[model samples]
Target: MHWVFLVLAGLAEVAFAFCLGKARLATGSESVGWYAAFAGCAALSFYLLNLSLAHIPLGTAYAVWTGIGAVGTAGLGVLAFGDPLTGPRLFFLATLIGSVLGLKAVSA
Candidate 1:
């Protein structure tokens, strides 16, 4: 259950990063609804991650949250925004995802 929140927190952080770019593009000033939504999503992401830390160990959750957010965000960028997905980069990303899952499995 708590792990679910952790995953969600990571996803929200990804969404937050994505929205930040959109919000900036949309408003040009980073103000109003987009600003509020971006900040609010980021804040909520941290809060949820913190809550999960009570049961899940800070180090693991932090690593997982950061790792997943990074991977997820980059993947989205590659797929949606035509960012680079070079062989070495993809290899490294795959390694990261595998290691994160492996660690989680070992911990569990």
Candidate 2:
């Protein structure tokens, strides 16, 4: 389904963000691999997004996709990069997620 593709694209976007962070932090040979992975993920994300857009409304699809990616990437940053998860940040993140879900429900 197109929704599946959209979700996959969002996940790919998350992976792309994580890979980009890893690539930036890495040095020597490891950096090269991370960079390559980042590029692959980015490509996959965009490709899947394009596929989803064929069926889903552009505004709805883009917002949901980016919302997923943003939340996922922020969570990963907290877990992997020791980024501070302040109360306000968590609250905003939850709000964003709720908005995404609301969009999906209404679109359906």
lDDT (CA) per prediction: 0.86, 0.97
Clashes of 1: 0
TM-score of each: 0.88, 0.97
* Candidate 2 per-residue C-alpha lDDT over 1-108 given as tens digits, one digit per residue, 9 for 90 to 100: 999999999999999999999998999999999999999999999999999999899999999999999999999999999999999999999999999999999995
Window of ten residues with lowest summed lDDT in model 2 = 99-108
Candidate 2 segments whose C-alpha is farther than 4 A from its true place: none
User: Residue-wise lDDT of candidate 1 within 1-105, one digit each (tens)?
Assistant: 888889989998998888776775675555566777888889989988988888898889999999889999998888767889899999999999998897688
